[model samples]
Target chain A: MPSIECREIYFSYRRSDPVLKGVSLSASPGEMLGIVGPNGAGKSTLIRIMAGLLKPQNGSVLLEGLMLHGLASDDRARRIAYVPQDYHLVFPFTVMDVVLSGRYAHGALKIFETREDRVIAGRVLKWTGLENLADRKFEDLSGGERQRAVLAAALAQEPELMLLDEPTSSLDVNHADNLMALLDRLCSDQGLTVIMAVHDLSLASAWCNRLGFLDQGRMNALGEPARVLSFDRLKSVYGDSVKRLDLDGRIVIAPRGKRNTNA
Target chain B: MLDMDKTRRKLVLACILGGLWLLACGLSGLLIGSTSIDIVRALNGSGPDAQILLVARLPRVLLAALTGGALASAGVGFQALLRNPLATPFTLGVSSGASLGAASAILLGLDTALLGSAAVPLFALAGAGLAVAVVYMLARRRGSLLSTNTLLLAGVCLAFFFGAVMLFLHYLADFGNSYRMIRWLMGSLDITDIMVPLKVFVLTIIGFILLYSNSRRLNVMSAGEEVAQSRGIDVDKVQRRIYFSGSLLTASVVAATGPIGFVGLVVPHVVRMFTGPDHRVLLPASFFAGAGFLILCDLLARVLIAPTEIPVGVITAILGGPFLVWLLRRQVEN
Candidate 1:
């Protein structure tokens, strides 16, 4: 199966200027592709469209070689899972309760969870290293735990394609790297295809197999990390005050250090 | 596994207990009254007890139980839709539209027309439908519905607009007619027509089943729209279903009972405290609890200051308002 593929997509909000313009990309299972962009670059918008949350104004999305438009939402959900930046629940649902909600498409008409659903939820929670906190209210968890809980929830969908929008924006460095590592492991071990919009360039470079630099509603660059984050493209897209360093075959892009007082 | 098992257990227990509670309240409504009827004679159909029980009390009680069940279910649905615990069945302007219809009908002297009693309910139902249509039109962006905030704002604004129209009508009416209008606005379940309860029974069954089946979808929505969609939910379709189903349910009950307040607002909260907000359990638990709560409230309306019966709406407000505060305090303390 080809997983999720977007073809020359275009989208705008309420007749405003287009947020995304003629973008085309395809991701396959066993790959982690990161879309890196500045604020207002439409990374989240693209991710949302791919997750089937928003309709692209032009062009099309295909899932597993079938048109995304024709696939029923329930069936699409069985194949794809999306993790947003934030998950806010007003009701005090427990961790297990939230995780089990991911199993919804398994039995469309089943109101209560079957034994199999429970078993899957339990396994996902453990896989996410959250078994001890399964009984706690989701709101009670720390920021990192909640993020993992959300990831665990998506994994419970048993999806072949996972789309995440700004998945680590609010996370601290330690938790952010941990979360990315988990995605990397899942892609290799379970053959899951991950498409994520990431703000931090170096982080995206570190984990993703392929990186797409999106700027001003357009895809400016798409390739391996070293090629995409070239010195010239980095200065042009991000402006001055940035540096790219290559150490031990790893590419790390960081802000210029100890610049003159006003330069 | 433990948490999942506990939720399943809670669902089963709530259904069994709630069914029993609904039955008990229904029987209490039939048996206990301000003018006590001799059950033996009433069942045998041989005395004035039969006339009093069948004609006056049975219909009122049946209407109360069904309306209570319906309002509470709608309340749960709205709270989930809005993702706010404070949302009520009337939070979206349906009840206000119904009130405006009843008030305008009274001003037009439909109260004294041929088949007058049926006029108010029919007008109220129409008004509720029209109001929902207006709110939907305003809340809809392009073709999709409810950005949630837009729906809530549009609904609140429509309620205010309809309420002003109702008040203006109330001001134009004569003193006696105005009194009738206000009494209807306060919501009462004094119908003598058994058919009203029968209609409510049918609507409640359909609405509850339609809503109950969407419990899984509602749970996914609790995690927000993005997460909900990735889980294979059509957010727009689900939102439309809840809005219409809840509006239809609340509309039917308001047409029959004059917009009984608080039962729809507080009963879900009370049940949520027990069932912990799983719609599968919260819905059924709230229905039974609300039905029982209203039956007792209505019973007290009859007997609390006997011979000068309080409005059932008044009873629910007085009890529900304080009970909600108490529940909030308990939750905070815990």
Candidate 2:
């Protein structure tokens, strides 16, 4: 009942240059979908639409066959949790306080947390490996730690769908792997539907169940990673500079890897 | 769980100091007049100068304290809601708008016996409300308030524009009316209208209590509007309440004693310095401190020229200007 489906989506920040053009996709509960594309492929725009943060100019987004926009903001917040690409802050709220704010959509009359609310927030913090940093100020945390804290905060909402926009864009290798593994486990163990736009092809291919390749605000391919990340599709979507390498059962597409081939 | 011990300690401190300040104001109001009276004899209600004591001095002191308290508390509310250190009753243009309304009433020759009594304050409240409405309409984006910079700039510009209108009205009024208007703008304590102080005092106390209870929410809101909204606060509703209460408080104070300056801006920051940013402690402290500061300023205004009173606004501005410079330097150094 909490499935998300988009039909004929179209959006643009400016009238002449549409960011998303007639894009349609569906994601059921408990599935992890990875979206990959070159820059300006409308990946971020699509995530925002799915998160209910942005409205599509033409077409509709439905959560379990119900129109998403018609629902109350609190109700939408309850069902869909969004972690944006950039979250800057000036205040120094504690990590626990940040996480506790996730329960905002459940009730409006009572703003303070109950015993149950604190327990849930604590549990999510523990789950996301942020229990040790509960008392630490959010701004004091590192990039990876901040991302995990945000993830914990989003998880505290207990939403059915989680939309993470480029979660690993600012992380180191160890952090990127750890975050991907965490998401993979959360998807499988807790049946959380995750739709993330990832820049790293290897990470997406390694963890995601399905992959969608987008180019020029249109979907080039939508299927298993093997089909979506195929050499022919990659060449068409990203130009001839993109080439796939097969070495010892690992697959990698070098964005500029071919330029160094003559070296 | 309540921290009863800390609360009790704060309460005791507030009461002791506040009570002392109140008594001092009352004594000064009586003792500094053209004819001084004995405090013990006055307290016993057997003093020979009881008529002047009961009629003139006590009312002026009480009116000053009440106006000061209201303005300071409203200043605290505006600063927290807007998340700006620069926001105050005067800086946000509420006082300017009130003065404009008062000047308008005078110029229209509506300062007659039948209508002048009520028209000034009512129109002042209306002017303040209209000013807030225009600022809100201009500064809101995507149903949220704009950044503090934009809001402060808009308020300052509107205050200047409204002040110009008020000055224009000053030129059209006759010499007597113009002199009255000038004194009013300079803000002097006048117990001639005791009923105004009594009405405003009751409303101010009630408003102060209601606002003090919501200080926790304001502390949370100062971080950002998005954070507050996501924490289950109906941001728009709370903001409307803050604006309404703050505007009314400034208007009432202006109505009671013309337009006092700087106490609303200065007292809250001074309160913040000692009490931290937690509004729970800061709000009540600012209220009392504001009353105390204004009483002292009024005493200075009286004794500086003895029997020929200087405007309270002049004293506040002279003191506040130097304090503001120090605060700015401190902020920069930090």
Candidate 3:
């Protein structure tokens, strides 16, 4: 069975306007699913629904044939972990403190972290290459490092499925590539499922086994990267003023040219 | 292993220092009062000195400690839940509502003997509860308490509304009633009975436990709401639990002590500077430091003018104001 199955989900922030409409998708074990979409196409909203952060007004999310929303929050968290696109730290929490919080569900009711919890947090920090910065304050980290810290925190959950919203948004190119490669390795080696909302089509195409294109809160395309990243599909969603080229058997998209209307 | 040991050692040292400081402050609070009783005589339980120490000073000191601890604990929870460092127990209009209730009772000439001296406090508690209920209802959206901004705005507006009502009551009162109202508003720890403090002490302990139990969730929550929920926290439940417990804590303290200012606002920040942002350590440490801090402030208020006591609230503001400004400046520079 699919690890997580979202069926015909519909959500609206307000009564008159909808943010997601009849969105259905599934993620299986040992696969990486990438969601690519334009701005405000409900990528973040969809991920939030799957993680059960936001309740969809209609439809349901199922995990292993069980209702996702019906499970206790701790139970759900044990199976699936989510990483948000942006985090704003108001207090000066250390990186170790941030990572240790992920084991909260596993800890006893009184909220003290155990020695085992520390071990998991430390291991995840090393895996994310954040052990050296564990003592630094979260607010002091660079954007790329901060992103990795948040990912490490999620990793400390030891989830079977991980959902990330624009995990590479704050990372430099080298760091972004490294993160994607790490996620790719984790999925294959650990038999984990990763569903991430990505804006970079090239990275998504390279790392993800499946790509889902979203537009106007609906799934515009869903298939292999080569099939979903077609020139016609790209033009339809992103407008005709975009160009695509094949380099090293990879698809690259860019704006067609600078407008010369002034001349 | 080395780093964990060092952190553990630092925490233990802080606890030791805080415990010693609190003990010293407690002794000074007992020894130094208006009459300047001899500490040896008071401890020996001889003559009227013993009565003054056991009957008057002991209750006052305990009350101050409980109120201070409650306010500080609530403050930490409020700052975390609201995601604003500036948030305090008073940020939600609980104090203003309590004051309005007390002022109205005084202005209307309610008999103090009627309910055995608890009339004012009961009214104040009711008013605080009502104000929080209104703010909670107004801020809730789509069945979730997800909007901290909306909650903050609602709380501020309610505070203004309650403050206006209080001013109108003040305007309507006679001169003697107005004087009593102002005195109560200034916050005093002068109480003869020990029941109120004991009851509130129990309540504060419960509140502290509720907050401490959720301390780890609060750490994740400080990152953001989405982050907290992503880590298996029932965000709405946790928010509701903390908000209710924090507000109730402030309400109970305000009912007894008449809105002691700055303890709720400054103590948590001060404690955070030493304990870092881990609420597990921050909450309990704030309780101890706050208890000691207010006892010291109350001692200062009692002895500075000796015979004529300044309001403890005034002393707290005088001490906390400059410290807050300096802290804000540092925050900006950083």
Retained true contacts (fraction), each candidate: 0.84, 0.12, 0.71
Candidate 3 per-residue lDDT, tens place, A1-263, comes to 99889899899986667988899999899899999989999999999888888889999999889999998888888888999988887899889988887887775264566778788999999989999999999999998898889889888999998999999988877999999998988999998899999998888888899999999899988889999999888888888766788889887776677662222
> Positional deviation of B282 in candidate 1, in angstroms?
0.9
Q: Give candidate 3 regions above 4 Å deviation.
A: A259-263, B1-12, B111-116, B327-334
Tens-digit lDDT track of model 1 for A58-95: 99999988888788888988888889888999899999
TM-score of 3: 0.94
After TM-score superposition, the amount by which residue B89's alpha carbon in candidate 3 deviates from its true location, in angstroms, is 0.7
- Best first by DockQ, ranked: 1, 3, 2
> Please, what are the lDDT tens digits per residue for candidate 2 over residues A179-222?
98888888888888999999898888877888888888988778
Candidate 2 lDDT, B12-78, residue by residue in tens: 6766776687677656766776667776667778556665666667777778888888888898998
**How high is the CA lDDT of each candidate model?**
0.88, 0.76, 0.86
In the predicted model 2, the residue pairs found to clash are none
lDDT per residue for candidate 3 within B60-160, as digits (tens), equals: 99998888888998999999999999899999888888888888777767735324367777888888888889888888886666478888999999999
Candidate topping DockQ: 1
Interface RMSD (Å), every candidate: 1.4, 4.5, 1.7
Best by lDDT: 1
Which of the two, 1 or 2, has more TM-score?
A: 1
For model 1, name the residue pairs that clash: none
| Model with the higher lDDT, candidate 1 or 2 | 1
lDDT per residue for candidate 1 within B129-207, as digits (tens), equals 8898998889988776467888999999999999888878878888988898888888888778899999878877888
